[model samples]
Target: MTGPPNSPTLLREMSERIRALGELPQTSEARAEVEAALGSKWWGLRVLAIAVIGAWRDKAWLVERALRAENGMAGGRFGHARTQSWRDLEAQTAAKAAVPMLDPADAGWLLDRWFSDEPLAFAFYEYVGLRLDPTAVERRVAEEFARRRSQQRRLPLFRLLRLRRGVADRDARLRRLAQGGDETALLARDLLSMEARFRDRQAQTPGGAKRAKVSAGAARRAAAAEALAESRRRAGRKGRR
Candidate 1:
């Protein structure tokens, strides 16, 4: 089907409808309006429709519709493909945002799609990990971790490891890596340290907490920079020696 008209009037009307949807209860009729909006030819309108529906009702069917709508976009060339990837990422993000309302089985289905190596699937997997039961996906996570780690390009593996570490509270492993002077681990450590200090300050000064929090954040950034510089200096000295 031909897409909706890319006109200011259509944009204004959709915006008004979305705003109205926010005011009303999430009912089947309201959801149908959102589904109609998803059928718009304009990518931006489709994105807005997904956002509105995902925000209002966290239904799996709506999530699936958003994914399908994104996939319907035609990619004509390299540049078009890149734009399609971005749009797909947006829709995947919207779908993942509704994970809290998804059943465990549906969440697992989403997780399995990550294995397909489709565009934006990894990003969706990351979001799904935050909500799904860790035990249910442990085996898949381990396999993914090993597969990514075996590759020479290790950034993706590191990210997966970091997420797993955070979810599992693998503090000892993080501490060991920090001690071994891994830059990312050190950064994580610095952030955690700053957070603890910030919490303490907030507890001590509930009235001026906003200013204290800002100061604490600035201090954390400065300290992180100094720590990174020190590490570089140490590496340089060791190299020279």
Candidate 2:
């Protein structure tokens, strides 16, 4: 599969992409490359895909597909490979457009994914090369976590729960999960603690949340830049060979 920084097909995609500006992106070949990278076992290849989709002109189904790929395969509630939870913090931040584009039904769907036999991988970072501003689909992610506090992948889901934090029953849910006295519950407790600290810190400053968000974004860009630079260095070596 070929795309982005180099590839004739990607150039074709660029052209088709521009012409279809008012509509969904029409670069089928480019989309295919993105899909392939999203599913690749090679982490570098996945990184490239992450960069690609971040800037892809196709904003509809393609973004949806990218979200699914990044969401990581569920490891089951108790056995959650905890796909999203385990994602590199920078990479998850880099996938700026991911959270907001989720379909509302995704909470239920992801719950199901959490229980399925999906194969999980941690590759996805290169391809297109950079992510745009994030749009938080906090509601959807929060729903997934709230429906089951002990659910697998609690990290990312819990992180997005700020909007739902006002719900009166969250403390009760946390208490219930904490009582489980299992690893899953333990992990949830840790994340909840961290979330509380973050929320409190944000509350303490007028622009603290914004600055923190910027910090996460900057970190993701730095990571992507370093990875892409390494990817390019290797690509240069390969071409010379």
Candidate 3:
């Protein structure tokens, strides 16, 4: 019987099922339910099932199985036709789930994949690798920085800026990035400009302070964006990739 669009019952039932999967006795029956959910017609169900698989993998019997399953699922191109498939979300989920278990070699492999993978998952694989071990990834980025082309360097630079979580380091990192001559640098410049404008806005004396600085930054940022676009066009890319 169909319930009214996402009725309370469905939500509660789904939540209970997920919780059950996490709490179950690690029986074959529970494993079967997990597999069945993976094969469901509803994508949301499949995603939740995958997440549940991650959630409960610490149980003794499930440890290896969950690892293998997530690796397999991460490799799939599964989705219905005439609709968009989010390759990144589930990949990200699996990546996050697996971080605690990663060895140095595994983290290294992920960094290489993040750099070379055709369809990247938000550069978050880079994030995951770094989160696993910041020094290793940072070393790789520095070693590879000058060798990679502009498009190639963008994400790594962006990720570097992100990994600097300390306020002083973040500010310094932003300034350093904003001065570079790449797409990532353009983004950093825009971000710094935006932050400045936001501060000026808080003063409310914002009349002259905000206008002149914002306009100058706006024009520069716009030009930087167009230049980046033209570079892409020259490279035969119209953005969607």
Candidate 4:
């Protein structure tokens, strides 16, 4: 729901903000604007709330701009409603705070983008805007990712086989996609694993260490198991169809 930028509540809030600022002897209107908003009743607190909880209007302009760009709405003259990949948009938006000195109008854009159904948008805006700059944010993110990975841990055998080539936290995302039976995720996992194996072979060739070779019997059994899994997967797809 797009509306004029200023609303009744916003106007009253501004008046209260101005009144709060005019109280001080040395404060300019701009400075007073900041201070009054910082000091007034609910209005001041609202500004503070925006700052702490990741304000869509104050800090997330770049993110909003990205969403608009992705939606092909860069001109702002509304076009035909376009389908959007919300997840990809969110990932890109979250990646923005990692960049420097984004524009302020983008903040307005972000506010417009802040719809309730977009949980990832809200989560990412909060995460990037608030948690990004702590001295230890990266460490905290890594720890959280690790915690989730551990809680969902598979067998040690799976880990050994998966990492015998080298699986990292990125693989955890792949695993999630596969569990969701997402074809894109399955294809991505296959490509990543193939590339990893190729690189491993290239490394091992220099040392003349033969790659781990599956015995013929073991290979046959593995192939049979894979075929059964494939059959089940195909059946599931067909059933859904």
| Clash count in backbone of candidate 3 | 0
Clash list (residue pairs), candidate 4: 61-106, 61-107
Model 4 stretches astray by more than 4 angstroms: 1-57, 65-167, 179-189, 205-241
| Model 3 misplaced regions, further than 4 Å | 1-19, 58-96, 100-105, 117-130, 149-155, 162-167, 170-241
Instruction: Give per-model TM-scores.
Output: 0.48, 0.29, 0.51, 0.23
Distance (Å) between predicted and true CA of 174, model 3?
Answer: 7.3
Residues 101-205 of candidate 3 have per-residue lDDT tens digits of 556666665666555633434333544534556567657766666687666664555445444244345556668757768755675675556545544554466
lDDT of all predictions: 0.56, 0.44, 0.55, 0.39
> Sort by lDDT, best first: what order?
1, 3, 2, 4
Cα-lDDT of candidate 4:
0.39
Candidate 1: stretches off by over 4 Å = 1-10, 26-29, 56-58, 69-86, 121-123, 141-164, 167-241
Model 3 quality (TM-score): 0.51
Ranked by TM-score, the better of candidates 1 and 4 is 1
- How well does candidate 4 match the true structure in TM-score terms? 0.23
- How displaced is residue 157 in candidate 2, in Å? 15
